[model samples]
Target: MTKTTPQTNRRIVLASRPTGAPTADNFRLEEVAVPALEEGQLLLRGQWLSLDPYMRGRMSDAPSYAPPVEIGGVMTGGVVSRVEASRHPEFKEGDLVMAYTGWQEYAVSDGTGVNKLPAGFAHPSHALGVLGMPGYTAYAGLIDIGQPRPGETVVVAAATGAVGSLVGQIAKLRGCHVVGIAGGAQKCEAAVKELGFDACIDHRAADFPEQLKAACPRGIDVYFENVGGAVLDAVFPLLNIHARVPVCGLIAHYNGGTLATDSAAILRRTLTQRMRVQGFIIFDYYVNRPDLHAAFQQEVGNWLKQGKLHYREDVVQGLENAPEAFMGLLQGKNFGKLVVKLD
Candidate 1:
């Protein structure tokens, strides 16, 4: 039986675009009546909402791979939601699904891109973090582009973060020495002690570059680039000949103005070292290849079941807090994968 739909739905919409770091003023909360579902539509009650660095790009009206979220529009996000009413053949009431339902408490989907949760799923929220996009980003970028080898040194920035955490773990599984770069002591410690990295360098330290160089004495074989800026500059000299770099997120420069890298130096090094710096957008993998998705789910799912993988979520309560929580993510204030719990 289907549950009765709520008369009004709470939502957070983009109030304004920010010049640099976004603030609470950039968002607006509103209440509106939930629209009646059509014959092929299903009502989704959002449960867990993901807050990622990529959302920063979506908030802006800049040119990018995906279109920016329009002003007065609901902020874009991946959500774990429950079906309240289903007029669609492939869905039913009480079904939990993963969908891009944005920052709203309720949504109507025509079943496009909605995925049913696996039976006996222990943590549905993991779908927004480790088991979902972030995990796949780490897997696809590291394995396919980075191509880490046994006994080689692999480095990743934002060490305790959603993607970097998985990148380090998978590198470790491949028998590679993993070095992680994080903002502070706590995150660095978590990366080394909990996430099992060979060494975790504190990017906040005065001698961060020196520390990173020391950690990777053999030079970096594969550099999983997440947070760019000074971190990329530091990793540049340490990159080994013919090293592979999987360019993923650039969170460090996402909020503030772009950080200028020495192009001349990069060109000289590119020629002399023959390093492969390939930029990848996770969406490409989702579209170009489907097998990679299946491989990641099966392998990472098995690892999770066997206690070979660990995940952490920094869950913020309430839909109203989404704006503030998102701001904190850009500041690196959230300890792990930032998620919002509506219920």
Candidate 2:
């Protein structure tokens, strides 16, 4: 049996930097002191933590917009935690909030970066995925950048993923025909049946390009770029004139940065087709509009209740299995948004 101390917080830390794909060995779990809560701070016990694609970037000391996670530091992520004890008046015991608490069972908050969540919200875990960062990303990028016209075709890969799933559903609501590209047959079925996508093509098929071409009859008006390798290559030739491309994520090439080369013909097509390709981070938009969060909280909540918006989570039972679940994420093993559960 394991011993526990009231002052000790269990956490997962970066044990090693991954060369390509992060392995179970990359994470190290240890018990450490519960950090001292300052006068305007609180101690939080994590409930649900989000594991996303961006965590891969933090594992290495790469020159990027966000700082890298040090070898010994906690793995960075979003957390839905309950306030255990608060010295801060803004929060009291049992308060829940959305925060960047990383991979830890307990965390210290000065109430600086943490956003207070609703008091008795059911499915608080939804705050970390849908109705949260990923949902916001799909909202901003698709509406602002994609701008799909009614009757136009919108294509997206990783269609069953957190962001991509919302993107497709939103496109359908906009009167645009949506075709999703996912890995396996199961994900494709879920995309078409449950998510209400017009059709879904499996990227793992022997002739993906052939299937995608068959799916998008009018060519793609809005291409929500998620997995950027062979899938991007297939979609490149199908983009119609004046197509809008929202560069959201590149999960396929994320394991190892596969900087692909665009052919001269494709470059020529960009000029000939007049494609508008834009890449954005959601932080820029949501920062100016706190109301967006409130709006999404209402809209996504209603959709879930009305059975319009559906989400699937690949939840792991223990903190010990988190590393394996996370590692499987980069490879498309997890069927939905990956989250770790700890009692």
Candidate 3:
């Protein structure tokens, strides 16, 4: 099938660094002429763009595991695209691929760091969610770092989200009692009913800490840390001896929030409990452990196929709506893995 080359590429670029939460003003949309592909290059048309909490950190110039998105540059993100045209030997036109092509309608790539989607893959969008980065984050963080054992109590924050949902369900499959902490009652319900969490607490409730403690009568053996402000404050006291805390993200503090003041107490507890509080970036695993990624693809992919795992996406339509959707994501407004379906 012949594909028509796109003349213009529409992209969202960073206009200015955000102080607190990002607003629509921080992003500027531009339509520019598509550049011709050179040798060993591919022209990609983005179909789906992922919006994640980590992008909030990239919006700031603060010291982080990854570099900040430069001013006037396209906001950094992973995209699932189709190869509209290719001069690259390894890729061909009409192949679906996953790449870090940012928030754009079209991109030119030299095929570096690009992974072709398996032919006839049922859900291509899953490459951006369950079968992709978020899925790996949950798998590695929970299995490798958290190391949940049978009958242990595991608590996951942001429980209905892409990572947390998988974390909780995986814990259940491993024979652990999984408790989830989510924002509202509806999400809390979904965490238990849809995601198969043993119990889910609403962090927005006034008695949230009490409820979390009540839910975990055996004490938390593993805490998958995602939203780490008030949730951390509540979970800290209930951690069992030798508990493992895999700190994947701190979304509550992403928008220039205050640091926790009770560091001394935290250290004291860590010392007494012999807790393993480790932080990890998924990129490190990708570089060091390709085997784990393969194992994840096999195991999780099977679970999905057998209808043992669940995944969700809160999709937004159009490139023009991405900024507003992203802003909503940081505020816990999105119900699941947020993605933009580019028009």
Model 2 poorest 10 in a row by lDDT: 1-10
**Candidate 3 lDDT for residue 16:** 98
Q: Clashing pairs in model 1? A: none
Candidate 3 differs from the real structure by a C-alpha RMSD in angstroms, to one decimal, of 1.3
Which segments of candidate 3 are over 4 A away from where they belong? 1-4, 259-261
- Cα RMSD of predicted structure 1: 1.2
Model 3 misses residue 121 by how many Å? 1.7
Q: Write the per-residue lDDT of candidate 3 for residues 26-130, one digit (tens) a residue.
A: 999999999888999999999999998999988889898899999999999999999999999999988999999999999999999899998768988999999
TM-score of 2: 0.93
Candidate 3 clash figure, as a count: 0
- Candidates 1 and 3 compared: the better one by lDDT is 3
Once model 1 is optimally superposed onto the true structure by TM-score, how far is the C-alpha of residue 20 displaced, in angstroms? 0.7
lDDT of 3 at 68: 91
Supply the global lDDT for candidate 2.
0.85
Tell me the number of clashing residue pairs for each predicted model. Answer: 0, 0, 0
Clashing pairs in 2: none
Tens-digit lDDT string for candidate 2 (1-343): 1423258888999999988888888899999888666688888889998888888888988796689999899999898988888889889887888899989888888887888876556688888877789888887778879988889999988888888899999889889999999989999999999899999999899999999999999999999987788888889989999999888888877686553446676678888999998887777777776776567667776777777887888788777777888888888887777888866
lDDT of residue 120 for candidate 1: 83
Better candidate number, 1 or 2, judged by TM-score: 1
